[model samples]
Target: MEFAADVFPGGPSDPSVLTQYADHVAGSVWTGEERLELKLSSHGKKVHSLGRSVPAIEGLVIGTRLSPLIACSVDTGDQGLLSSFVERWHRETSSFHLPVGDVMITLDDVSSLLHLPMVGDLHVFQPLHMDDAVQMLVDLLMVSAEAARAETGQCRGLYVRLQWVRDIYKRRCHAGHWTAASREYLLHLLGCTLFANKSATNVHVVFLEALRDLRYVVHGISYTT
Candidate 1:
């Protein structure tokens, strides 16, 4: 049956349409084992493991002006509460139609909460060819072209495992390779915080360009977020 008819046989203009629609939506909610599992990542544990106490790493983080985030903690909060807010979110108005009032998270809220700058040229990503992605990964991460190709293959040419970036950091975060190590750490940081995905295991490699110069990291954060 058509969804609108199923929800309110009398049609949208009916006085009871809102009530009927709400009931229909509530009835459609999944329960118990039928409910989909929600994924959450605190990312604090991994961030602490980056050996931030080391002078070189500390200096790199300070230089990039992202030191404020080192102490930041994330709480997933109550899933049911979050779900209720999601249900009330009105995309047309870009606000939550709560019983109290309509509200939404604004860019100013993001800037204040995350302590990130709000003004910069926004980043625009285009479709990347597999070959170009592989080459970019090899150049930025200093990985072998064959290994880059293999990793890109696993994530449809646009993403790579966050763990892989961590591994690179482990190999490079030392006296001779600290610079490369810092870049890897920045990549991992961006993946865990700003551009986090539902999978929580992978991050888009397009961010590699942003980390090519440590000076631009803050500018990158402003625009990308």
Candidate 2:
């Protein structure tokens, strides 16, 4: 199917928006255990897409994976953030490698995409007191996963989403600027999100991979363990 028209007609190219979107998901998201789902109708009704994620899993996914996935951006607060995030996300999904769009998705990507929850773009930013960038990552992941699980998926329209995310992330890592404290905190948060998210996604990926490898259940036909 033809992908939706550019979400940011007057704002920026899909590639630029990809960078800004990832930044928002990484740093600004709230720090909590609440599942999230989002239907982003912003930037002049340009991008019509819906996504979701779980509170707990969001923490796990962002807190774990690394390299060309997603990242935090406290500098321009809109750039380089995606890289920080996907860097971790890619690491988390390393085991599955399912081709989650343009990016060869791994089991983590598939499962996370399968289970992601939904909320709204309004919730992307956390309260002032909340500074756990890692938590934000997890929450965003959960939301993304839920959107992915839907039968009418955004993924169907876009194949380069993952690759796009990774590319944006790389740009951020090389170009983003931040305070020493913010940098340190975010770095720490990145580690936290990486371990947490990767651990969670890996469990799902490994389990499914094992099941597939073992053929425990094929086409709904049960195989003896």
Candidate 3:
């Protein structure tokens, strides 16, 4: 099945949640025993020494910018699997405005840190779909802003993403890599949503607006294409 179908076969109209998607993906490929063996085979002695561990567990998290979305745990000693989960989680949630806390991926003493990249342009790691790519970047900034404010209770650090976005916008405009429609969409997002000034606490508002606009653009592209 296609990635979207595997994750959301019901299509955009469906009310399926992210938890269900995570569960399905984690459970579908391998049985509990098989998953354990696979992890051991891959990691060897290091896997066995990761302290108390469990089989496999998966979770999904979703929430708006106001609150913590989902809090779940997985009990696996396999560091590799934990890393993969963190990477997958970043890919899936890179379009939202919420700042995700650490997702515990093990039941034992084993643990891994999942930190979203903070310094570079997120577009560098984006997939080929321009619409999704832009949305991912917008979301990353939103999350970074939230994290920064949550840590320091100030949004001034968000200026980094804002600055990077401005640089990217300028470069993209000069390169003419975007279609007229894409250009227009991005211009509106940058002009009306992101670059607009707002109070520090309301910084998430910019990201929310950008996200809403990106959703429309993606929908339009899907329908017309």
Instruction: Compose the digit string of candidate 2's lDDT tens values, residues 1-225.
Output: 122335433222344323443333322332233434432211111111111112323433333232122322112333344334442332223322123533454445533543322221311112221123223322322223333333113333211133223232333334431121222222222222322232211111111111121112122211111
Q: Any runs in candidate 1 off by more than 4 Å, and if so which?
A: 1-27, 30-34, 51-53, 90-95, 222-225
- Predictions in order: lDDT: 0.69, 0.27, 0.30
Candidate 2: Cα lDDT at 16:
35
**Residue 15 displacement in candidate 3 (angstroms):** 37
Error of 3 at 192 (Å): 4.2
| Candidate 3: stretches off by over 4 Å | 1-135, 138-161, 179-215, 218-225
lDDT measured at residue 189 in model 3 versus the true structure, 0 to 100: 32
Clashes of 2: 60
Higher-ranked by TM-score: 2 or 3: 3
Sliding window of 10 residues with minimal summed lDDT for model 3: 58-67
Question: lDDT for model 3, on a 0 to 1 scale?
Answer: 0.30
lDDT of 1: 0.69
Candidate 2: list runs displaced more than 4 Å: 1-160, 177-225
